[model samples]
Target: MSQPQGFDQRDDQSDRALRPKRLADFTGQVPVTRNLSLAIQAARQRKEQLDHVLLSGPPGLGKTTLAHIMAAEMGAEIRETAGPLIEKPGDLAGILSSLKQGAVLFIDEIHSLKRVVEEYLYSAMEDFRITIQLGEGATTQALTLTLPPFTLVGATTREGQLSAPFRSRFGIRERLDLYSPDELGRILARSATLLGVAADAPGLATIARRSRGTARYANNHLRRIRDLAQVSYGNRIDVAVANEGLAMLGVDAAGLTELDRRILGCLATHRRAVGLKTVAVTVGEDEATIEDIYEPFLIQSGYLVKTPTGRLLTVKAYQHLGLTPPEADENQQRLF
Candidate 1:
């Protein structure tokens, strides 16, 4: 199974091994990586710890991977955890206190942090210290613990949910975008070589086109195809083998999953803009999953459009289903 930014732990080992160890090895995300490279270089030139960084983007786009790459580039040990895991102030404090000087503390899904815990980070990020109350009522006393100078790297898909003060503290912030088809192809090629899978360009391209612009999906898709190839294609994955695997998995030529097609099918039936909740109910998916995971690619690939009202299937979506679409006029185009 694919790790989410994979906080689930079961997929950690392979996830880390497949991840790019250096900034140079990381693919796509040119603009973010460029600025980060300069920032890391400048910090290294000064012989100082890099500033706190916040990486915002959809899941599986390599925000956590970039954080790890940064730690490696800085030659620092990285401690990793998710925001919800660090519940109380003491939980946050303990992680901060245990860090060595110049360590990188990576917090994934940082937008999920409780307000109390987030507030505790302000001082730790700024003055490198945290203050905690040490007793009950009459005996209560505030005690401050100084933390080692370190970098805080946080990754989240919901950047808008972050508080203003919390967002302002990060010296470096970057949003990772979806990868292009060619970029995913390159990533899949590298992964195939690493896994000792014999795959041609067409095989990789076939899988890449179905990866929905996410590296995590690309890797996952490649591995599945490799397994299928081993069973029937003499361990060689060609375009035909790739397509057969994808067909079995229910991933279409356009990379739409069963859920994605369900969302589109809902739009087709609605024949008009529909709210996310409606689609979620129709497709048996959570509203957030529809908005975050499935919708972006549908919109990007021109199969769907988000109107002021809701989501509408584009002409391309209907055509993909082998059905004729209603006449789309200039008015509908403007709504897009």
Candidate 2:
């Protein structure tokens, strides 16, 4: 799909579904968007290239899309790769040496790079030069290759895992938060029109509320609902069709999936705040997976809350599950 300014070719259909062409098309992330705009404008006014950028966020939140936008804004060619794909330092060296002036090297999942490979990147990012060893002999000499000025756009889901040296190299650091329900609803409505799917406002609202503030999830649900409408009713998606499709997919009114229900069940039945580790153990999932994949949505929907002590169920959580609040817990009662 054609991206706005700074993106490369996308492989996933969902990426194309909500990919914003320019800064204006990208929804939500008001502060980050504003900051990026200023940075781009300042760079253009100086007639210099933009600095290297690092985007940290959960998956499916438009890191890749924004990278493409940055490239477009600069009118530069983008070369895409992942950190894990660069097995040796030479792999990254070759790609870096090939970059043209003002090119963008977009590296996804950048926290997974090996220490040696990461060391090589430090010099490349700072001075745009790669040192090569000629031979292991008495006459061995070091050859330094100076590269054209380029930008590195790195995306990572786990910012904490990146070493301070690597993180500090990025001139611009932006964090992406989950979108609001209203923002997601607009995204769904826009996508529906673009994809030629006929959906009413109510239908789009239903998809957005249940999307857990994720544009990718909203688009995915809309596609499923459209399929249901075509097969069960006609090829039109309205409120009734959206509700039926969501019900069949086992998504609750608040957009909690089966895993979310399981987490809430454990918290409510225990009648105490539970640690994330214990909750992950009980659910048979890793702590990182739970935090990165499931907890954001549950927390946003008011189905879960992280206290100083541990994870607690909110009043809305009990009501959604059709359960009475425990009488003895003062905090739970007060929350209601």
Candidate 3:
């Protein structure tokens, strides 16, 4: 396949290069990090390399950062690639064969790899060998190439879609959970210091609460707020300036963006629970994006609930929208 432009390709290599040097710098996922640290230390003690690792999580949750950190700590050369980029088996073979000893091959979105390419990876990951067949005749022979003892770090957002056999190959498999408000606040403050932005306590807290507990969202909000502050007022970002910036961006104090409001509005106004399809259509977002990006935060914040019937707006959501809950809802709540 021809190379796709603007997919996993960005000009922010400098920012990417300085994400985190060690596992300690890569924040969040404490349990996974502790387990992985133990595994790495044990491998080092045994004078053997760590086994293949699989990180499953939503996007922007620091899978790539952790991969780089692992390579840095292991003192190995890192080769980065994505699943879609490796179209053919030869593409993977060439990359694997060129690796130096103990190199780290980080493949992001590993679930997208073609079946043929994935099959080749299974053998390479297990036995450090690749079999290439030559000629079409009955006398055709299979040539086996020995690969260096390297690590394959696969990151995927959809772990369920991965084939069972493929999923079983990784020695370490962990999921990155969504960050809490406190964790996101710390991340925002850290990134703010690095970006040379003076954010007060209230400003940081506001951004953190409004960031929906995602470090990427928090960082992006800070960037926008900083730009707004620089343009409208002085470069200093205080609570007032932050609130003004967020208001102009249509993000409320509760971290409910305009789209989020629309979703709740539909559910509240309809006076009944609605299916994901209906919610997506009303909000003008794809169902998958709603589930992956927006719904999780809303549900976690007590603004929405996934019922057996469908998506229901909670009393808090109704209050946020300046609406009152129905008597039936109140009675049902009391009975429950």
Please name the candidate that would achieve the greatest lDDT relative to the true structure. Answer: 1
Give one digit per residue, the lDDT tens place, for model 3 in 28-67. 7899899889988887787677799999976667888889
RMSD of each: 2.6, 4.7, 4.0
State which candidate has the highest TM-score. Answer: 1
* lDDT against the true structure, each candidate: 0.86, 0.83, 0.81
TM-score-wise, the better of 1 and 3 is: 1
Off by over 4 Å in 3: 1-18, 135-140, 326-336
Show where candidate 1 strays beyond 4 Å. 1-12, 329-336
Quote the positional error of residue 188 for candidate 3 in Å. 1.7
On residues 1-336, what C-alpha lDDT tens digit does candidate 1 reach at each position? 122221235545776678998998898899999999999999989988999999998778899889999999999999999998987998988888899999999999899999999998999999998997888999999999888899999999889999999999999999999999999999998889888999999989999988889888888777777889998889998999999988887888888888787788888887777889899788777777677777777888899888788888877888898777766662354333
Which residue pairs overlap in candidate 3's backbone?
none
Give the better candidate number (1 or 2) by lDDT: 1
Candidate 1, pairs of clashing residues: none
